[model samples]
Target chain A: MTTAQHLAEQWPGERPEAARRLLLAAVDSFSSRGFHATTTRDIATAAGMSPAALYIHYPSKAALLAEISRHGHATTLALVEQAVAGEGDPRARMRELVEQFTAWHARGHTVGRIVNYELRALPEADFAEVAELRRRIEEAVKQLIEEGVAADLFSVAETRTAARAVTSLGIDVARWYNERSSESPEQLGSRYGDLVLRMLGAQVD
Target chain B: MTTAQHLAEQWPGERPEAARRLLLAAVDSFSSRGFHATTTRDIATAAGMSPAALYIHYPSKAALLAEISRHGHATTLALVEQAVAGEGDPRARMRELVEQFTAWHARGHTVGRIVNYELRALPEADFAEVAELRRRIEEAVKQLIEEGVAADLFSVAETRTAARAVTSLGIDVARWYNERSSESPEQLGSRYGDLVLRMLGAQVD
Candidate 1:
């Protein structure tokens, strides 16, 4: 097997750095050139290896994209889940969710782009898999909104739409967010959290 | 000039139906295969036209892309400008913007996709030209939010970010929106408008 082929082998270990290298390259190429536009060769070259080496690590370009998309969505879901699973009123939990979400996207916008922008490019089965997880995330947000409505924290004719709007605000961070901009990611997150809290009529401070 | 050249010459205007036919083919090919992965032949074949015929209306693939992108943005701006220009309360105007935006994307989804998803393909000069109009629309939203804040009709820190969120939600409508599954575009627009207004804290009947 080629050197590229050798690297394609997944060792049974944490190997965080190697995984990070692979994911980072995948995200850059995926966002810049798109899924179909990018090639395994391009990704491997960018990762400082031959395409064969990439295959040893990744079976195909679709697989690489799926891995990245899966990780990114799972990460966002984890953060969001953690944010809302905490103690305090539903409003407080919602604030935490917003803060975590905005901060994550602000700092790592590319991850969001990879997760959301490339959703359409995923192969049908893979797309369905990712969609299931995305639906989970959406449900989390939906539940949060429903809880807020139940608590009289948020008044809306349709909790589903409210959930979608709030979720869209958060999901969109990946598209227009910039970490190097004037506002720090934390500051931006807090600001957005404030807005979300107010919108929901949650007690601030 | 070849038929491709002819397509370029009459493109985007003279033959309205043909323009849309070619544009739809272009959107699918561009989004799926991307500009480089796709060729004039790919689009021509998709449009069921000779490559030369495709060129007759579009000078080059890049030109074809630019035209589609231009039409999408311009149409959006026109719709918003029209929707908001009428005499209505700021809250009403916000609803109008959301309704018009969602409807436009739902109806002109392919155009929206090509406009948004293909930004990177645009040459630097072309990119800036298209992006400027998008920026202006964004700025207009910011201004609206700021006005709401000033008038105590709405409350949100960082009008700019709220505007970003709002625009982000609307722009991404085409990315995942599907008409076949369920939910009419008007319903989505109306529902989206309702949520946006509530988020903005507009206490309207």
Candidate 2:
């Protein structure tokens, strides 16, 4: 599927369809124009609504960004959480987590790009919450690496740095992922899973 | 030892002191507010110049971005080139490349973040030039990995993916390197160098 199609399926939070359209429109504007440069009118017009109609869903453009940021963060956090929540060997768990995380960034790259890179655009007050959520996401990955090391499944020296490297592999996917590339998200994720395991000195099968 | 000091030392790129000040201002503004959100006025005012004074150095804000983008890209490419030029071995070359690349991103992170993330804001024609430069950078890493594989020094399965992961580790440093985090750029680069060799399945010494 295309990035736009995949983004519509992944994000949008719990808002109604109409509000979801506005959020998606805001994402498109923010993705292309940068959040500060994107006006409410641009979002509204993109959503096929009157400028005032946006206020019915979000009080301000910042609110719109906050919603998208919060929802995207929550969704990604839950994905990592779920990836590690299952019962399995830590090696299997690490591979699964990398696969899921990498695919999320690739499939939902539009929202992924904005949510990953546009952190500064959120209001400072809103940024605190979003940052806390990201902190949790990073922690989740760190825990996985720590587990792998504890079980003797991985031989990583620095758990924190290895965790950051694993997370970075996925996050950077949004920066340079081209759907037209021959590699599918699943293939990329699998390769990344292998690479992460190798980085930790875990045997890759 | 600060990111600012390192940036000044690393990337002035033959411009006059006055023009260098403007480019630095552009980097700061683009780093925080992003390319589209920042006005030429903001850039000029940040540089302690009148609005029109910016035009004397660069024709347009886009021109300023192109100059900054091109210089930043070329600087990074040159650093990577120099790292691999006089290397002892392919594995050593790879480690040195990652070390320098990671340090460059960490130390010059303000400009690094813009050069790494703000490519989308460049005009299509300008982006093409930047993209070609980036392609060459990636190819350099790819060549190093291929060399390691050919010499039986590394056991990477996919040279291209391994190369991309090595590059990603350094590029993402720009996004999350915090001076307050206790890991200096030198320390981070050292750790990253070790980790990268491990990822390439080379023995980490």
Give the best candidate by lDDT: 2
Question: How do the residues A1-205 of candidate 1 rate in per-residue lDDT, one tens digit apiece?
Answer: 2212222332224665555466567777877787777888888888777887777777888888888777677777888888778988888888889988887777667667777767767778888888888888889988887888887776666666566667777776766765456777788788777667655655444
lDDT of candidate 2 over A1-205, digit per residue (tens): 9766776776546668879899889988988888878999999999999988888988899998898889889999998999899778888888899999998888878888788788877889989999999999999999988888787888887888888888988999888788786678999999998888888888544
Residue A114 displacement in candidate 2 (angstroms): 1.0
| Model 2 stretches with alpha carbons more than 4 Å out | A11-14, A203-205, B11-13
How far off is residue B124 in model 2, in Å? 3.5
- Please state the CAPRI-style docking class of candidate 2: high
- Report clash pairs, candidate 2: none
Q: Name the top DockQ candidate.
A: 2
Error of 1 at B78 (Å): 1.0
- Which consecutive 10 residues in model 2 chain B have the weakest lDDT in total? B6-15
Error of 2 at A198 (Å): 0.7
Worst 10 residues of 1 chain B by lDDT: B1-10
How does model 2 score by TM-score?
0.96
